[model samples]
Each structure stands twice: as structure tokens, then as C-alpha cells.
Target chain A: MLFSIHADGPVPIYEQIVAQVIYGVAAGAVKVGSFIPSVRELAEQLLVHPNTVARAYQDLERLGVVTPRRGRGMEVTSQAPTACRSKRRDLVRRRIRDALREAAASALTPDEIRNLVDEELTAVNGKRR
Target chain B: MDPIIETHDLCKRFGGKRAVDGMSLAVPKGAIFALLGDNGAGKTTTIRMLTGQLPADRGSAKILGQDCWAAAEKLRLKVGYVPERPRYYDWMTIAEIGWFAAGFHAAEFYTRYQQWLDKFKLDANARLDAISKGEYAKVGLALALAIDPEVLILDEPTSGLDLLVRQEFLGSMVGMAAEGRTILISSHQIGEVERVASHVAFIASGKLLLTATMDELRQRIIRLKLRYEAEPPDAAVFGSVLQTNGSGKHWQAVLQDPRLEALETLKRTDGIHDMEVSTLHLEEIYCALLARKV
Candidate 1:
């Protein structure tokens, strides 16, 4: 239910919502068959237009990540986590691609970029430990 | 999609000053559209014309396919208008005023409106003259919803409201919009409107400067800062540059719809040292847009 966004990002807000929800499912943050807040509820919480949230919900439904329950409102589909794995991987690839692009722009060689990535991964792991 | 409200070249003058001049706008159905402008920028006049409260001097406005001026009685049934600082019979209590206002609708509507009144927590017995500005606003909202109106025209609905009341008012609007009611709200509260409004129309000195979806506005109006080796003379490379000014090496430029090519051009340029792109907030963008009377 919590997501961060760059308002100026090339990706629109509705897409961000779809990607964030999918990421949540694939990453174990959102369990399968759990209830996601209704569009109005999410819009108020995020302070966005309800239509925006509704569009995201519709996209998620189209992607089979969420399903409409007759009485209980929207719930994540049972197969959503598996369905979202590829999208989650795509998100990871985008971040890695961005980092590599930046490193290339900074004139780093492949070996130097690998070392930088290794150092960053170690730091992240250390924090986790 | 058919617009719930449409106006064409709507003109209005007050004491030789053109309050609304050649204003044309379309509010899409089910959209929570915000008409934003500074005071005396004809927001009130436009709202008046749209709601059929005041006739336009020239041109026309339509709400729900009925001419706003000629067919006001018919259109009033579908549209609920709440003007700024709504006047009420001071002698009447909230309950009395509500009952009086409900006379415009059927008894069933009045029955359904009781829930809304409860939601707003209005003391029906309290005199209108004795209530706070926020309480009076709640009364106004209660009556407006009493008819289950298809369109709600709110002119500065949250102007004098306190923090909690304003929050509640905004919450009610969200609920109403979810029910598929078209809302045209005019307010100076850019931050609040930015959160809820699907579309925005910026008016300055009786003329519209921009009308766009909130997302489009955020993406299109951008501010960029660049540091160059010397006085940068190539701001035109950025598409639709609005204004640019800075001394020798550092220059800041505001642009509309700045493209990636421009950024790439700046990046590859020899003299440019740094470039920063930023999205302006609605308030800042409004000021920048209206600064030159455009």
C-alpha cells in the first residue's frame, strides 16, 4: 500500500501504481488473495484522483494481478505473485540499466563498473546484516 | 465523451472591466475539474455564468445540454451551485434553512439528505447567524447534496474553512466524485486541488492561459538550471522556452514541454558543466505563467 513515485518521471502515475503493486506481490509484501484497498480508499490515502487509482486497478485486473470480489471488494488473485515475477525482474533490470548507463557516462570501464557494483552490493548486504 | 459543462466565448463585464473575456472551457463528464486563478481573475464570474446565476453579456454556457441563462430553471435541477460566502436567512436555524432549501426538490431527496447532514454534523437547531463559517459551509453542502445533483459548482467552497473542516469538505468531494457526479470547483487552494482535481484550467486576468490534465501539466511545465562556461545564449534549443535569465555562467530557464533532445544537446555541449531539471509545483507554475500577463 506504500509506494514512492517521481512525479516528473517519464512513466505515468497509473503505470507506477501497476508496477508498484506487481512488485509488492512478487516480493512477498502483498500476499495472494489478500484485499487491496478499494480505489477510492487508495486515492484518498495517496491524495490522487480516484480515476487514476481506478485506472491502475483496471490495469492490474487486466494483468490478472487483482480480481474483483462481489462483496468484499478487490483482492489480489491467487496466481498474482507468479504472474508478476517477470514484471518485477523488469523493474530490477531497469534500475541496473540506469546505474550502468550512468557509470558508462562517467567513463568507467566494464571491470571498474563491476567493482563499483560489487562494493555497493557489499554495503547493502552489510546494512542488512 | 460529452462534456458535462461547456462554454464558448463566454464574456461578462462589470463596470467597464471585463470580468470574463472570450472564455471557452469544457468540463468532461465525471471529472473533478478545478478552475484555478488569482482573485479578480474572473473565476467567480465564470462560475456564475456556468451555474446560471448570472447571464453572460455575450456568448453562451451550457450545463447538461441546457442553456445556462435561458434554461436555468430546468438546468438547476441537475446542477447544485454553492457560491462564495453563501447568504442565508439569518433568522432561520440550520434545520429551517435546510427544509427551505429542500423545497426545490422532492420529499424523498430531503429524506436521503438527512444522512449527509449527519455526516457534516450540523446542529439543525442552531441559528444560521450563530454558526461558524465552517458550520455554514456544512449547511451549504448538506443542501447541495439534498437533491442528488448531477453536477456541483463550488465557487471557493473551502475559502474560510479551518484545517479540519477543509479536510472534511475535500473528503466529501472525493466521495461525491466517486458517485460519478461532475464537479467544477474554483479555489485558490492549488495544493488541495492538485491532489483531487483530474483537470485544471488556469485563468489570468479573465483569459485562460492553460487547460490540461494534472499529469500533463506536471510533465509539460518544467524548470531547468544549467551552468555554462560563459553567458549561455542557446536557451532556444529547449522547446517553448518561457523565460530565461541568469548572470554569466549560470542560467535558469522555464520551458513548456522540454524534450529529451534538448537535455541531450545540453549534455553534449562543450561549455555546459551541469544541468538540473525540476518540476514546478502548481503554485509556482501558476505564478510563472501569469507573470507576463499571458
Candidate 2:
């Protein structure tokens, strides 16, 4: 999987890996039954500690996103798509809520906030086109 | 599991100055523990004690449950050491140096040393004196790992290395730790070590300031910026602040509040009109914690 890790970002590196895996599965970029990189492989590739990657893999396993495949590496689970899509929605919703909170804290009126959100949606849609 | 390396009140004095003072640390097995500090902050002194190069003035240090000073010779066989500037006989070739080291280690050393030479891409026939500093360091690392020691002690091993060599060194360290080997490295290179270190112990002025797992540090400490409509309260209002900056209406603080109770309280405080709370990267966290000492 393609992972763009921001080592210096506020998010912990392992958490970033976990989120990216979910995002990938949700977007259909990572197919079910495909194996992700092994802990050692990902650690060397990302130049991070193997333990960090292991922790991410362990969390993914617990969340039912991936499963150990005997001698092979971790395979994406069949149920991952449904679980990850809902998780992705929840993640985006939380972010939007935080943004709305910030807007409200700025003393913007509700109408002003609504218009700002509309403008942001239009800009994002334009970029998509 | 017991810590692979542990020290309690480990103190060392160089004449009147305390080079290491009352340092207590635990390096868990299989951990990439970074002894982080600025130059002259007693990192080398602590490593010296741990490697049994210098006996501590007071207290004790143990590696693999053996006293560092008492069983120095026995511990040497089980521990691999790479110093900041590794030195070898100038006339000896790289191959000769490895052969010389293999004599003191297990029989497997010969094959492992050769494998490492190939992996590091060092020419076996290159004279130690003729090789670049980076190559010299690589030779030292190769010899150290060839022993297959349970623990590796590195004192600023990457100081003279180039960017790619440093990355290679760190990648090798990750690979080693994955095999259940413990590594203790002393370095002031916070950004480079941040990715590989599982736990970090911050030392300053010969004293240990903090020791924590990287994940714990990430989850606990919080950086907060607050803007008050009126004058800001005393910095002490947030209880024990690690570091604070700015003044009057605007203020910033790094607090070690696991539950973020302080941040929640400040958000509801009467005069505070705006606030921003976020976790920091390791480098930023290190500086914020050390700012008070400076």
C-alpha cells in the first residue's frame, strides 16, 4: 500500500499507518485477500521502527481489518470494506464537527457558518471536476 | 520481562563536576532505547558506565542482570559496542580487522562478519586508515553485529555518517530489534532517532529529566495556546506546566496532563476567549521540555 507518513505531524506515526490502512481499504485501493507488507518490510521501507509497524498491524488485526495468514503476511479481511467505509465516514464527520466547533468559537453566526461550508463544498467539487 | 539494562542513582564525578548524577533508568529488552541529550549532558558518561568502561562513583548499573563494573569482562562477550569515533590499527586492512575481532568472539563471528562486509559494501582489502569516516563506522558496526550479542551499545555511532548511511544504520537497528535484541544508543540527533526509538530518556546537566515510551509521550503531553479577552492568569494556573511562553493576553504552555483536565478547565475559564490544544512531534516536545533548563 502507498503510505505517506508525516513523521513530524501531531498524529503518532503508528496511528497514521492505521488510519491509512483503513482509508486504503475504504477507497478500494487495497483489495481483500491481498497481503500488506510485513512488519520488517514496512519498517525498512518507511525507515521507522519495526515495533511501530507491528503495533499498527496488531491494531488492524484487532479491528478485523486484517488477519494473519500462517506463513504469509497479513491479508486484508473480506469484511474490511464495509467496516472501513463506515469508519472513514465517522472519521470525516468528527473532523467536520471539529471544524464547525472552530467556526462557532470564532463567533461566526450560524448562517455565516452555513455559507462557509457551502463555499468549501463548491471549491472541493470544482477540484474534483 | 526484566529490563535488559537498568541503572539506579548512577553517578559519576570528574573532579569537582558531576558528569552523571543520580540517573535511574530501565531499558526494556528488545527496545531501541535512545539516551537523548545535548553534548556534555552526561550521555557519554552514562554509556561509559553501562559498558563498564568507567565504574560509577555511586549507585549501580546492570546489563542482562549482571553488574556492569563487576562482570565487565563477561559482559563484554555478550554486548557489542560502537563508539562515536571508532579507531583501529592504521596498517590493518578491513578484512584483517574483522578477523582480529572474530578471534575474541564465537566461531560464527567469521561468517557473520563476512556477511556484514558484503551487506555494508565495504571492501575487505581497504586499509582502515584509507577508508572514509563513514566506511570506518560501517566496519565498526559490522564487527559489533558479527558477535551476535544480545545487547548493542552505540555512542553517537552516526555522527560522521552521511544521510544514506544514517538511514541504513537505523534500518539495520530496526531489523535487529525485530529479532529481540536490545539496543542502547546515545545521541543528540533527536529527529533522526525519533522514528527508531521505542523509549527515550532525556538528560540535561548530568541529571535525568524524563523517561517515557514514545507512545506515552505522544498520548500524554499537550501543547496549548490560549488568548484571553483580558490579562492572562499566572502560568501557575495550569498547575505544573513543563514550559510556558508569551505574555499578557496571549500565552502558550506545554503541560504533562494525561487526561487533558487542565485544557478543558482553561477552555471554560472566564477570560479565555480562544484556545488551541494539540500534541507535539518528538523534536518539538524535546525542546519544549528542555527550554526551562536553558
Candidate 3:
């Protein structure tokens, strides 16, 4: 599975994993019943702790995005796409709320904040494309 | 809820020198807290005090709500300590050592011993005297985990391991933390600590300089590299700039800003060609923080 993380972001590494997996499911990169790498493998790939990856997997499982199968590793669930998308939207909303708070604190105009968000969105989409 | 580990004005002295001076910290429960410092910076002394192996010259420490020194016997049973250089009986095999260490716990050792032996990939038949240093460290870690303690205190657990083994060891520690075990690890390996620790306390010259979450500390330190069109920028606003070199036209220095308010100070300066605001790794920040004290 393709996994990408933003090292410079404010989010913790585990949360980043959670967000990315949610994004992956929503984008169909990880389909229903698709097997994800073991915690050790993912942590090695990300140069993080296996426990960090495990935390993400556990969180995903709690949200019904993935199911843990003993020694078989984690697998995406049939309800993953919708649940993941919902979770992603909630996360994005929280981020926006935080951004808005920062903008207000800095006394930035709505246009300036909107333009900043637009610029970030454009950059993200441009990279994806 | 009370902190799982706490010290109030804790001090440790050796002869005339004080290793830890007036140190105080409270680590939240179920968090991976790290102590970052240079050698002789009191990291080891702090760990010893927390584990109740050494008495504090002043103040006190509490581990799991029990006095670290006064109630050491009961407290020690609940705590698992992996010293920097863990020693084992050379005459014993890995299995024998496991069995010996397991004697302290009230539970059956076979299941947990087998689990840890598999987790650490240690051969039960291998003798402690014959294993490599890294292997020995793994055995020590396995012994620590097999006891099923409430708190883990590790002092440079992966100090001498190769990169691969170090990664594996850290992976195992992280797994332990996932099970809601509180861990306090002291190590000079900032990158590895950054991977697993939720909080960090940096010490220097026997003093606790800063204690904050990993995310909070990252946001506090900013690395700025500037190329000016003229002479070097004035140093008054940036607190103290260290290592200002590159002749008169260009200069670079690591600056300290506890609140990261220096960016505004930089924006006010003129004759600047280019500047980049970047984050400093934990190692760089540790070095800078200690260097400033000197």
C-alpha cells in the first residue's frame, strides 16, 4: 500500500497515520478486505515505533475502518470507505477550526485567511496530480 | 489523577559535586517521557533516584504514588529498570536468567518468559556469557518485560545496539507503551527518543532546563538561516546568537527564543537576502540548550 506522511506538520505521527489511512480508504487506495502491513512493517517504513503504528491501527479498528485478525494483520472493512470519509471530514473540520482560531488571533482578514487556505489546497492538489 | 512519576526539588550529590540539583518534574500516566542530556548532565542520576536505587540528598520522588526511597521495597516490585549496562550471571543460560528474574514476580513465568523470548528473538539455549552485547541488552529488556511491572525505567537501553537492533528494541518499547504502561527512558539518541516519547525533559549542568511535550518543544525552537546583503544582523533582538561566522557579509548562528517571538524581530531587519524558518531536530535543540548554559 502507498503511504505518505508530512514530517513537518503539527499533527503527531500516529495521528498522521490515522489520517492517511482514512484518506486511503476514502480514495479507494485501500479497498475493502485489503490487507494492511503489519505494525512493525509500517513503523519501519515510516521510521517510527511499531507501537505508533499499532495505535493508529487500533484507532482505525475502533472506528470500524479496519478489523484486527489475530496474527493475520489488519484488513479494511466493508464499511471503511464511508466511515473513513466521515472521520476525514471531522478531522478536516477540526483543523479548519484551529486555523480559524489562529487567524482570529493574528487579526488576519477573512480574505487573507481564505487565500491562505486556497493556496494550501492548491498545493496539496497539485502534488496529488 | 496523581502523576505516575514526580519529583519535588529532588537533589543528588556525589562528593562535592551535585549531579541533579533542585530538579522537579511530573510525568503524566501512560506517557512515554524521555530525559535528554549530555553525559554527566544528571540523566543517569535522575533515573537512579526514580528507581529508588539512590537516595536524593534533598526533597523526594514518588513512583506510582509510593515514596521512591522510603517505600522502595514495595515500589521496586512495581517498577522495571533496565540500566545502561545491565549485568547478568555469566554462568547462566538465557532461559535460566529468565527463570531467575521471574522468581521475583508472583505469577507463573513460563508463559510470559516464552512470549518475551519470542518477542526478543532470544534462543533459550544461548548462554548469557556467550551472547553479543546487543543480545545481552535484549535479554535484559526481556527480563524487564517478563515481570509485568506497572512502570518501566530504561537508561540508555539501546546505547550500544546497531541501528537495526535499536529499531527493533524501540519498537518493542512502543508496544509496551501501547498497553498503557508508563515509561521513562533516558538516552542521548534524540532521534529515536523523538519517535517514541510523548514528552521530553532536557537537563544541563545538573539543572532541569525545560520540560514540555514533544510537539510543544518543536514549536518553540526555530532554525533561521539568513544571508544578508551587508554586515551581519544585530544580535540584540535574537537573545544570544552562537557560532556567528561566514565573514562580514554573511553569517549564521543558532539563536534561542523560548517563545519563538524572534521571527517578528527578524522581519523588522533590513538588507536581508533570503531567510528560511525551519524546525530544529531534538539533537540540535539539546545541544543548543546546553551550549547556551556554558
lDDT of each: 0.85, 0.89, 0.80
Which residue pairs does candidate 3 place in steric collision? none
* Cα lDDT of model 3 by residue, A24-122, tens digit: 898788889988888857765665645568778889889899998878989899999999888778988998899899998999999999999899999
Which candidate ranks first by DockQ, i.e. highest?
2
TM-score of 3: 0.75
Checking candidate 1 for backbone clashes, the offending pairs are none
lDDT (10s digit) by residue, model 1, range B1-294 = 888899999999999999999998999887899999989999999998887789999988998878999998888878888889889998999888877877878787667667777888887789989999999988887888888899999999999899888877887788778888999999988877877889999998898888888878877888888888855846667867777889868889888778878688778888887788887878877887877454
lDDT by residue (A41-124, candidate 2, tens digit) is: 898888787889999999999999999999998999999999999999998999999999999899999999999989999999
lDDT of 2: 0.89
Q: Lowest lDDT 10-mer window, candidate 3 chain A?
A: A43-52
Error of 2 at A64 (Å): 1.1
True contacts kept of 1: 0.46
TM-score of each: 0.87, 0.91, 0.75
Per-residue lDDT value at B256 in model 1: 79
Best by lDDT: 2
> Which window of ten consecutive residues has the lowest lDDT sum in model 2 chain B?
B255-264
Off by over 4 Å in 2: A94-129, B257-259
Error of 3 at A94 (Å): 21
Question: What does candidate 2's lDDT look like per residue over B177-228, in tens digits?
Answer: 9888999999998988988899999899899988999888876677778888
Q: Is candidate 1 or candidate 3 better by lDDT?
A: 1
